[model samples]
Target: MPNYIALDWEQDQLFGIEADVNSGAVRLKRAFNLKWPDDVGTDPSARGQWLGTQLQEHRISASQALVTLPREDAVVRHLELPPCPADELSELVRFQAAIKSTRPIDELLLDYLPVEIADDEVAQSVLMTTVAREQSDSIRQTLESAGLTLASIGLTPVAAAELVVRVEEQQRLDETETSLVVWAHGDRVEISVIKRRSLLFTHSTRLTSTEDTSQHIQTILAEVSRSFVALQKLLPDVSIARGWIIAPNEEAETLAARLQERLSISTVSIPEISVRTIDPLNLSGSATVPIDVPGSHAPYVGPAGILMWASGGRAEFVDFLNPRRPAEVKDTRKLRAIVIAASVAVIIGGGLFWRQSEVAALEKAYLDAKSEQSSLEELQERAAGNVENVTAVQEWVDNRVDWLAKSHDLFNDMNGTERYYLTDLRMTLAGGSGAGNITGNGESKTYGEVITLYQDLGEHPERVVNTHEIPRGKDAEYPFRFELDINLQKPEPIEEPARDDAEDTKTETEEE
Candidate 1:
């Protein structure tokens, strides 16, 4: 929806639709009213209702459109800059424009475009265009009243340049070549030198002296020649390729003839003065020639140019006439901080849950280990009190058996074993004691006594010996108690089983 509405009215209103024929899309949908003698030097509101009514008839919305200021209100200037980085170029242009303009920087909008790129640097020509802030606000208010959105607002000359460039391109003309465009309106003559569709210079002078056609032509030619000369100095080695005279047929012929005689260049007359078809609702019924310059053709070029610029055509020069305001951008640092804080909170919460899970697992393991250890300790204590438990009784019995075996072997192998005999026997298990008495015949008595002592002792070696001994009948009987002491000796090494015998047997069996 690149379509917009352009309104260019100062004296009498002129309206038209500038649509891109290629896409069948509307570039500008507009309506305007001319000022009457009573409305001269007055605000545009004098015919606002009339213009609004016309727009309503044509189904044109004023809110979503762009308005153009009269050429008199805008100051257009060309500026040059040393080749520099693109990012820095805007600031540099603003700084330079501020210094050059008469108004304060805040009161103006600044816009620019690159003209050329040379070497690794950008040699650029800047367009400096400005409108008073008050005037712009008023225009906005008026348009807004009609429910129109003012996408852009600019001056007439810039719009005119835009139209000329489009016509030039549509005609398949070279843009780099200098061309002279003479836009003759009611009382004003807009003379411009365009090089390669880019406006090199513009000069608008009153045509009050047109009463003498010949002199008028001469005066126009002189101004055009001066404009060309100045442009040539700025752009070396360039010449006018053609001359366009936009006026009534008679005026166009006169201007063309004068250009041929003075400039030695071909001249073209554009008779389709109305760049577009007229809207019947807004026009007066008075039978005026459709192709006349002062009637409908005068505003077409400028308005059409504005339409073309709004439609995204290349009009580098127009940018000087309509500088763009900087747009406000949002801050991203605050957004980043918020995101980081949120991420940290999530991490801390997850860590807490993980630590709680580990603690719970360790606590369960500790309780289980403590229970098992307590049960094992209780069993150990019970086993120490009673020998009925097999594991504990076996441990006690094994210790006693080992001692008895050592003592028996020691006594049997001793040199004087007859002098040693068991006097009194007392046996103790791990937690209780047993005392025993024994009687036997002479030769069997001694062995019987030892056997009895060994049996009652329950395999206990220490208990089979006397704990306390004394003579029972005193010195008359000469009573004596004998005790045995035994020391174990190192056992001889046992011989290993013979391997040669097994091998001989295996050989014999194989032979068989």
Candidate 2:
């Protein structure tokens, strides 16, 4: 729902309209044609004041202003180029502008719009427009004095191009066919070539009353034929299949019949003015309409088209005097973005390098720890083997019996007895225990003495136990034989054998 003011400049008067150009629903809020006093151009301030008063009086409220400078003040060029990078294309356009513009490149404000062509084409063309600074300066100054800011400045043909494209889009016309738009304005006819809803070429021709009507029509047709020839040469793939004449219905029908007869192409009468309000404005009333124009109800379609162009129409047009483009601000922002991106890249690189170093140090430390652990495990195994050997030697020493000390004790015990002789002596050592046996024949004065010797030997603390004495009857004069066994430590009591019946009876008789 945004609105814009489109002001058309003529030699003696100014015409304008404020409308909503979005959605192809242009709502005309107000329209006005203000006449300039004869002396108004002499005083610059008087002209600005008059413009401001007219705007206020009509209540034309708009934030953005678009002006169509008189076509005489601008230079237009049609340039073609091969596919190139954007930077190179810009430089090429500047170079071309220097050659094509009458004014020096520095003094001219230049801009261009790409002429839409086929998708598969290798070369692209642009319509370039340039206005001398001095020529636009007065308009800018006047607008500034009137407390207005000029957003865009363009030529009238471009505005007309915008109008044709909008009408085709709203009506849903065939988009692929090449269409010739023959626009009639005042005494001039603007012939434009459109393909895929895009403008490719435009040329202007004027008619005078002195010229024959038929010749004038032929002249217009010849110009169109030449334009078609030029387009076919430039874009060999494209062909003009149809045409639309933007004039009165009668004039359009007559022109259509003549074009079909002469060139064998069908034509439609597409009028310049549209009475259909695509959409209506929120303003109170349509109080002031176009003056002296034939159809009072129909709005001035050209100015409405300009408003549509300003409201971001799809058709391409150059704003040669774009006040919004400030070269210093653009360069500053680009440089700032580059510096920030470089700083971020450097920081990221530094951080990654630092992280890599830390990882390397940690990996080295882990390897060193692994190596030390292996060495400690090997040392532990060797220590365990040494401990086993030491324990085996200790056990061997502890279990060994002192056999020499035991033998000496036995010999010392036997030294105290001389009446007994050791006919045979035997000793055995097993599991750290020792035992000895003795056998001998002893002679005393009587048998009692022998028996007494046996008793005495048995009572010795470290000597004999369980002694047996036997007499060999008249074997020799010393007829007593004895046996004795000795224990190294105190012995458990012996179980005695059972005595026979004869021995028991003999012992009983002796006691009685």
Candidate 3:
């Protein structure tokens, strides 16, 4: 079951029903009739608050609502046009309405019933309905203030027509002929004509309030006659085989009896509510409201009619909120913008993917370089050990004394001797630094020659020490034997003396 709230906004009163349709029948769950507060007058806020309080007490929980605008609130037009394209019908109606309306067309909200056979079922006429945008917004705001959302909006006359047609279908009436429906509630009467389930004509007439039921009946009869004459002018050969009356059973029976006695309509009776079930005990929203205050079940016609429109009778009703419009135009600029946006998104996505791949490749390269660096570090450790060994050998070679030069100098000293010979000669490190000693033993023919050689070796900065000297046999070729230890020092680095250019020139002049 689908739930919806049906609201009928009448002058000084708000009639509502919370219902659900089961199978094809509308079951009234809760109903309310809130009168405008006498203290608040016409203040919308106070009215909304009072209505909300009443609803809360009644427990009307359906949030979405269908509203019925009183017939006077909308402008209705019936036009018979030359057959045109279905799509162009809307534009044609709009242009015609604009020409007729005193106000700008943009200020009005419009809805229409499409072309349908006239009351005669031969000619066709269109019903175009419009309401002021300000009126529609006011209704919307009023409902919103009462904690209700506006789902659809429609005129009371069209809704009443829909109700009567739907009730006719339920009663298994002959649908082949045109039907006329009369709905009287509050201070107005709604008269609608139908053919083949399509609404042909509907009119709302205000009545003066009177205590006499006969007077109401007489006034209704007069209006019914006038409506028929007017309908005849629109559809010359109109055929209305049956008629329906929706009102309280007493008033309905009286009016139907009177109509049957006077009019040519074959059958005129009250449309049955078997498809719509309402409990009188459940109708009142507030506990304080008396069950008998509503008097009869007839006043719920507006809500019930709109409910029918919301359910399945949509094609018969004109909804001002959601109306038939002209052919929709497509914007080429919007299409181009969409295409451009899609292209930009694709480019950005591709760029991001490329950047991600590039970053991944660079990271892999960095890891590979790190691995290669580890291997190079191991090779460097081996090379460093080899370099230290080579450096140690180079230091040894550099620090070693010049043994060949020492031996040649010693031999030159010996050549000065009468007889000279060396038994042993060795170079040993005298200190831990780059200095060593040359040790040798030699024999000379005379002691004087040996002494002279020692004196020659004992030059300043070069040390010569005589360890032992002995006389040899007289027959020996050398008479003296000597042991000598000589200390050889590493050469000191000498800094070049700066030349005196003036002194040199002076000396050159003196030499010249």
TM-score of each: 0.58, 0.56, 0.58
lDDT of 3 by residue, 1-512 (tens): 77888888876787777888544456667667777768966666666667777788988888888988887788888887666777788888888889988889999998788645634444345888888998777777767888878899887677666665655555677665667777777568888777766677778888999878888989998998888788878766666666667766557778877765556532232233111222222222211122343466667777777776665663367877788877777778998999999999999999999999999999999999999999999899989999899998887777777778777876765665446667688888665543778887777777777677777777635455555556574547776787777877777779999999999999999999
Q: What's the ranking of the predictions by lDDT, best on top?
A: 3, 2, 1
Q: What global local distance difference test value does model 2 have? A: 0.62
- Stretches of model 3 off by over 4 angstroms after superposition: 21-23, 118-124, 265-294, 327-512
Whole-structure CA lDDT of model 1? 0.54
List, residue by residue over 1-512, the lDDT tens digit for candidate 2: 87777777665777677766665455666677778888777355677778887788878777567787644456667788777776566667788888767678989888776766666667768767778886567777766666677777877666666666666675776676666666554465666777665567666666564345566667777777776676666566665555656554335556766665554531222333221222111112221233333322112445655666655665766677652132342567778888888888888888888888889889999999989988988998988888888886775555444557655755565465554444565554324333334333344335675566656556666454665656554536545565545554434558899889999999999999
Better of 2 and 3 by TM-score: 3
Checking candidate 3 for backbone clashes, the offending pairs are: none
Q: C-alpha displacement of 288 in model 2, angstroms?
A: 17
- TM-score: model 3 vs. ground truth: 0.58
Worst 10-residue lDDT window, candidate 3: 279-288
Ten contiguous residues minimizing lDDT sum, candidate 2: 274-283
In model 1, state the lDDT of residue 305.
56
User: Which parts of model 2 are misplaced by more than 4 Å?
Assistant: 21-25, 42-45, 70-72, 80-83, 115-124, 170-176, 205-240, 248-299, 310-312, 322-414, 417-512
